[model samples]
Target: MQACELNVIKYILFVFNLIFAISGIGLIVAGACVLSEVGEFSHFIEGRLLAPPVVLIIVGCIVFLVASLGCYGAIRESYTMLMAYAVCLLIILIAELSIGIAAAVYKGDFDSAMKNIMKDSLHSYNESRTDRLAWDNIQSKLKCCGVTGPKDWPSKTRPLSCCHPIREGAAPPQEFHCQDAIEGDQILYNDGCFDELKMKAESSANVLMGVGIGIAFVEVVGILLACWLASAIKNKE
Candidate 1:
């Protein structure tokens, strides 16, 4: 490879590294947002489902650090640093690919796994205060009653959060309200929490999967660039 071509490759890698670094920062911010939104219930969720965001934050930081090395190597035209960058890129590529494949495979069992987790959470609703609050929040946010339905509750009484707030000029129920409602007419939210939560989880997983695949493609390009640049430098030397 000619010196001029090597110089061009060096600049290309530098630009690519800059873009990759920005992507890493974006992932970190997104992961932090997810963690913040989930709040208390995050602990109760399945590890497989909860882990990706955290992993993204950690991996994103590592990628950012590695991108710096690539940028510096490209600027300095240092064979040693470029070689090290290539090795790091290879490792990141493998890790990202493994995570992407695992995520895809895990989607198959997501529904069953989510159902079991929600059931367990419901069973512990009264036993653990944390679980109880988490369930209440889930019920309120999703506007759902119980795991399967209102019947899941032994008393057949729905939490206050399950009830939609009374609209202006609408008189409150004369007799039974959401809390004591046993019949379908009185129940504020009859739908189960599992389905709503499952749908949300599936949607989130799809988005993450898409993002992972996109990142993997970029990593592949990075890996190829790093290897090619390293080879060209070696040949020139």
Candidate 2:
């Protein structure tokens, strides 16, 4: 009976260690990816601006240590080590729930506001605004209103001279005779892009938070099951 209980405990620890190790690997990989491109990406988006969370790095370290302990516990039939592993898992669960709750609280407001901003921005600088007019003369043609970069840009500088808008190493096709670049127009367009980007980012975060919280809950249940299984095996023995 004692041997059977020990075996059940060993199996549980094995599973615990495996799960934590997998989670650690995922965190490290995600952190690396975000860190690699944060600079360029951050220029265009809000959440992209910051470095990866320090908490993630800390959690990863904790997972590594606890998973090692779990492996040792399983190999040696050590109840104390298994208990420690369970405690660490509980801490991880609490952190996951906290983060998910924070995200949930702010999600609705952020989403609605972003949608409105994008819609307005799309209407204002749609790049096709100038194309709406008809020109009466060839010189007037030089000022034809179509964005410089789009397919409909005037084929000849005579009908309308297209001046491609050059921005930070990226030249956007100029519509022929684009109305003078309005003051602060770039800021507005960029803001709209940011709003759209954040909407996508938040949606992805919502899914990640759901998955993470779900996993944490499962881990807690798993820890309990491991204990129960060990107890049951001992009784049968």
Strongest candidate by TM-score:
1
- How many residue pairs of model 2 clash at the backbone? 14
Task: Flag regions of model 1 displaced more than 4 Å.
Answer: 108-110, 173-175, 179-187
TM values, all candidates: 0.87, 0.56
Question: How well is each residue in 1-237 modelled by candidate 1, as lDDT tens digits?
Answer: 398899899999999999999988977887776656553456446777777778878888988999999999989888899889878878877887787788778776866787787778777876788878888888888888788787776564456666666678988653247757753754477888887776666666666666667777888898889888888889888
For residues 1-237, write the lDDT of model 2, one tens digit per residue. Answer: 666666666686677678767777666555444444332333223352232233455666676776777677667655566566677778887886776566567667655654454334334433544322221111122222222122322233212222323558775545433434332444112122334355446544544554466557656765775455445544644
lDDT for each of the candidates? Answer: 0.77, 0.49
The root-mean-square deviation over C-alpha atoms between each candidate and the true structure, in angstroms, is 2.5, 11.4
Model 2 off-target regions past 4 Å? 34-39, 43-54, 108-191, 229-237
